[model samples]
Target: MGRGRQKAKHTKIARELKYDTYNVNYSALEKELGHPGDDQYVDKWADQYADDDEELETA
Candidate 1:
């Protein structure tokens, strides 16, 4: 059985290139990087992950 929705795939490059949040379009990024359809595509990229621990600390 499938989860109904697709599980986003992240590329090593994207992971390294941290964004402000997890709401980015990895497919577009991949195209920009000249590696279209290379099995690393995310649907979101938000900035919340930037200061992960800091945000938690403040909270």
Candidate 2:
């Protein structure tokens, strides 16, 4: 194919992809990831390192 034609085809495909809307299935995603729908997820390690981080910041 010619360079101009190839470039035009790429641009058309890119425009179509850019304008496409994706429908996200959150319930299915959560089930696939084994994550409960509860939003109270907490990081245990963050709490353990909180004091050490504050000490470094003061120094």
Candidate 3:
């Protein structure tokens, strides 16, 4: 969302999971989730996944 929030962390995770690259191409992860844009969208999707994961774990 805003700056100075460790945004690259999500991108790294996504890359490890084969979601996207530095150039931000929509990998299978983005396609499945219908994510648009480049790195920005990847970051947003990653955050969403993290939030969802937390919710699931808590549930």
Candidate 4:
């Protein structure tokens, strides 16, 4: 495409992104933000540093 047409298309897309508003799925948003729906998850490394804490306490 021509430079003018290319620039115009880019401007149109930028304007749409700048001015557009859409409905947000809040529950999906919460899940994405790390509020898990259950407590069954466990971190395998959660206790990995626990031994270090005891070393410091004894020293």
**lDDT for each of the candidates?**
0.61, 0.84, 0.65, 0.84
- Scored by lDDT, model 4 comes in at 0.84
RMSD in Å for candidate 4, one decimal? Answer: 4.3
How high is the lDDT of residue 21 in model 2?
90
Question: Model 1 compared with the native: what TM-score?
Answer: 0.22
State every prediction's TM-score relative to the real structure: 0.22, 0.47, 0.23, 0.55
**How much does each candidate deviate from the true structure in C-alpha RMSD?**
19.9, 5.8, 19.5, 4.3
How much is the lDDT of residue 8 in candidate 1? 30
For lDDT, candidate 2 versus 3, the one ahead is 2
Higher-lDDT candidate among 3 and 4?
Answer: 4
Off by over 4 Å in 2: 35-59
Cα lDDT of model 3 by residue, 2-59, tens digit: 6545678777776787964456566866787774555453453564455767789999
Best by TM-score: 4
| Model 1, span 12-35: residue lDDT tens | 456656853567898888778774
lDDT of 2 by residue, 1-59 (tens): 59999999999999989999989999888789885468677676875575777899999
In model 1, the Cα lDDT at residue 12 comes to 46
Stretches of candidate 3 above 4 Å error?
A: 19-59
On the 0 to 100 scale, the lDDT of residue 38 in model 4 is 84
